[model samples]
Target: MPGESELATLLRDLKPMLAEEEHGFVTIPIGSGWPQGLVPVATFAETEGASVIALSSILDGIGLEYEEGWAKITIGATSALSAVGLTAKIAAALAETGISANIVAAYHHDHVFVPWARRDEAMAVLENLSKVQE
Candidate 1:
């Protein structure tokens, strides 16, 4: 098992970006069953039968208001082991500083959403990590 710091460091190879952390309409307990026409954006808490999934207000059917302070560090289309590297990097480095991250992987890029208040700090951390990337 890796330490949290180590995990954060490793995640950066995927280069998780800091995106505007907006308030998303969260649904819980996907249940053993799934919702019809459901597309989840961020999932955080999970229980045996329930999980929290956040859907951005951008969804056509969603009329909820969102906070747009989230950050998104983009992974190139060629990135390998994208999730592993991204999870490790943020968990190790930024997570310990009381910063929160919500990771969402899309078809072409991996998006990381951070608190709106700490967006600049998160971006700085990512920029530093990016400088050292291979």
Candidate 2:
């Protein structure tokens, strides 16, 4: 099925859910292969290195230096890649409360990463957005 593209509908249906496992960010320098048995939820290649998001425990076990203590919030709505304003709206709402939001758009949905300690607050913000939009 095609994903939702209308901004209002996207906001109304953003059933944000907090993941149970804590994740972390790690960067592997160019020319270095990924750590053995490391399963990354997401990866991006840049000029300096390959950025990865994976479970905190897995990253620690591999002895990789990473910024840990992040909580992942997955937007339950399947938003289209062409959808606009969703990220901005989410970021703005979270920003109002000083919550840092790092949103990653995948083929079907958007995953938001926020500081572990503020996950509940972030979820509240997102839930409020949905209610207001409804």
Candidate 3:
């Protein structure tokens, strides 16, 4: 609601909560049509030719099929919408360090999905950014 600058400031003010969400992940081929049943577990990669949805499995019927090598770090805040460029900025930061991030911007927060091995480092970088940024 605020804005990118405001969101950054807010994130800076709040105590960083570094937690991990790791579990099943699957990439399904529903073509141009979405699957009608089964629940997705953690993350899903749905596609119709080139159009794709690397979406969340929070409350869907899609079942998760894999169980290794994925992690999520939630940058919790609704205002994160304002932090658009900032997300890419942080992403670039992670990228420079070779940590791939798959960002999911939910209604209430922005979730960054990273490789399981680099999750801790990713969290540290983000948390540190929140702290040092004024």
Candidate 4:
């Protein structure tokens, strides 16, 4: 099925699921090549380095400097890549509670990463957003 593009529909169906494992964000310098024994869930190349999101355990073992303890919340709704305002709305909602959201748009779904300590609060905000849009 085609992904939903309507903002309302997307928000109404955003069944967020919090991942059990904690993730960390690390930046590998350009030309460093992929780290050994590390499986990254998401990666992005920038002028300075390659940003990678991987399991916290792997990052710690590799001794890489990284921001750890992120909780991944995957929005169950399939949002079209072209969908507008979804990220803004999510960020805004989380910001209201002093939570920072890092969103990643994948081929299948949108994932939001927030501080691990605030996962429950983030989930609650997302659930309420969905219900309000319903």
Model 3 stretches with alpha carbons more than 4 Å out: 1-7, 10-21, 31-38, 41-46, 49-68, 80-83
Report clash pairs, candidate 2: none
Better of 1 and 2 by TM-score: 2
lDDT of 1 by residue, 52-133 (tens): 3444544335543344434444543233333345555654567867778776555455566677678778767766666665
In the predicted model 4, the residue pairs found to clash are none
- lDDT of candidate 4? 0.92
lDDT (Cα) of model 2: 0.93
Per-residue alpha-carbon lDDT of candidate 3 for residues 79-121, written as tens digits (9 for 90 to 100): 4454546567668778888988777666556667788777888
Worst 10 residues of 4 by lDDT: 60-69
Query: Number of clashing residue pairs in every model?
Result: 22, 0, 8, 0
| Candidate ordering by TM-score (highest first) | 2, 4, 3, 1
Off by over 4 Å in 1: 1-25, 28-69, 76-78, 81-83
**Top model by TM-score, which number?**
2
Q: List model 4 lDDT by residue over 36-105, tens digit each.
A: 8888989999898989999898888988778958999999999888888998999999999999999999
Against the true structure, candidate 3 has what lDDT?
0.58
Query: Best by lDDT, which number?
Result: 2
The per-residue C-alpha lDDT of model 4 at residue 92 equals: 97
In TM-score terms, candidate 4 sits at 0.95
| Model 1, residue 68: C-alpha shift (Å) | 9.3
Error of 1 at 56 (Å): 7.3
